[model samples]
Target: MGHSNVSNFVLAVTVPLPSLLFYLSFVQKCDGDRWENEYWTWVCDWGRLHPLYLVNVLFFLNVDILFWVVGLVQQNVWLIDPYWTIIPVLIAHFYSAYPAAQYDLLRSRAALLLIWIWSARLTYNYFRRELWQWGKREDWRFTDIRRKDPRNWWWKSFFVCFVSQHTFLVGITLPFYSIFTNARPWNAWDGLAFLVCLSGITIAHVADTQLHSFVARNNILKDLGAPTEPLLNRGLWHYSRHPNYFGEQLFWWGLSLFSVNLGQSWAVVGTAINSACLAYTTVLVERKMVQEPSRADVYRQYQKSTSVLIPWFNRSTLVKSKTS
Candidate 1:
């Protein structure tokens, strides 16, 4: 751990072995601003969700606990440099530090920053919603977890919500974390890679914003007793059934690209892991919506009419209109 060039990738894989066992222990009742209370609230029963959701919740919980330790290490002892400096500095110093990668620091750093901004924005957006839910109740996602495993909520949550989410968060943030730990400067390739990362995040951001705005308007109409439908025929929604997830996926991939520019590491694995988690979310959405007969048909029709990832003007509709 002394040299910026070295890290225990093996430790990364093996350290969480006990977490894999995850025996559910004493869980506190929900109440207060303390960490355990928050965990309890997040882990409490929801009255819905499949067994797979419990697996995700457990994973999320376990990873979070690990991250808490990492966070503590970061605060007390200085192992890695702060991300803010690690990024631009490493890109600038790639040639002198890790020359094999060019130290193509500029392009790689750019990619890292792109992922940083986009991921942070999306995360904060959700954080804001969580705050808004304050004084109301915990997230429905947690409710689903708790409801599924009532007696084992204590130990189950210790593994699921506490450990798993933090774990994913660390994996997702590793590209930047590695840069911070390495402490080099930017290189020429870093700039190009950064630009590419920027482009993907920008595209994703616009698409997500458009889709969210559409949903907001639709919800308003529904409240007013006016007719409402999913906005699949227009805007970014015209392209993907899950535009936000698409953006989130791109954000992680952008970060992984930077890691590839750096050296041999598990950054690519991080991206793949993130994809698997999001895929789980996508499947849940599919299953839940399919439960409603009418909604399912509209969703199925939307699937047929839309492009999954690419956004277009739906020129086919335009061309048909002209011919008619």
Candidate 2:
């Protein structure tokens, strides 16, 4: 066969192989009785909770390694985009399935529902951009990074890109762990948290839809060799420069609310760290936009008139900016 055919075969097999194995391993790990009967019982007995934590870490690492290897083969560091949306779903499901010594079925189920909603919407938005096929364009941010350090990017990406994101994924799901561990019954706080999370999901969906529509229209113009439109400054974009990012931050903070209600102060640490990370990300994204020759002036103008994260009453500012 040709080299292309060989590459295609490897791509098809390698992509799913690790995931299948990880799922099987997760299944086996979940079988507590089997672990108890095995020679590893001593290790399992050392700490009832330690083994569970260890398995969680191992499974995540398994997926993380597979993603990293796939990135290497594809030469596309954006391969992890889908995982960012999917990991929370996996974490919520895992914890909801195996609750701790004290469990609240109602709260657990509610939290799981909210997570699924957010995951489904976010993952759909991601997949809508492109099929998970090989040879597609990498995310612009990753492309920029790779361009900056052409020689060292591959190795640097292993630690800097994949591992760092994997760490964040694991850390941000601490709320799920906190929820599953506590026996807190469904209360007004849970209701409010759910509402906030649901609102965040809806806001993010709208913001993404608006952005997508704008990009599509601009891409059509560009395809016709026409000048592209300036930065989107309507709808959600009119109120906040990064409404979708704000929605994402809102979603995590809402999740963190559950932990706050449970008096698990440590779990809120995840939310705080995640917020800081997002703040940094927002800065990077805005800087990138403002540096783009085409987008720079328009984005700078938009930034001047719009809030950075919070959506506020900015119609007057928007109108004034547009007229000027």
lDDT winner among the candidates?
Answer: 2
Candidate 2 on 1-324: residue-level lDDT in tens? 557445644664465455456545544564475574564554444434653465356545655677677778777766566667777786676666541335688888888888989999987888666543433465677788899998988788787667777668777888888888888688999889888999899999999999989998999999999998978889998899899988988888899899989998688776787789889889998888888898898787777778899998675675878899
Q: Give lDDT: candidate 2, residue 39.
A: 45
Which portions of model 1 show Cα errors greater than 4 Å?
Answer: 1-116, 127-139, 181-188, 310-324
Q: Candidate 1's residue-wise lDDT over 1-324, tens digit each?
A: 333213333434343454344322212232223435554445433201222244345444444454335434432111111221122222223222221222234544554456457646654554343332211233455567778977866556555544554456555655654453443566554555566566666666676567566677887998999987743456666666676667666656766665665673675775688688878877777777777775788777666666655555555576679999
Estimate the lDDT of model 1. 0.51
lDDT by candidate, in order shown = 0.51, 0.75
TM-score of 2: 0.85
Clash totals in order? 51, 0
| Each prediction's TM-score versus the true structure | 0.59, 0.85
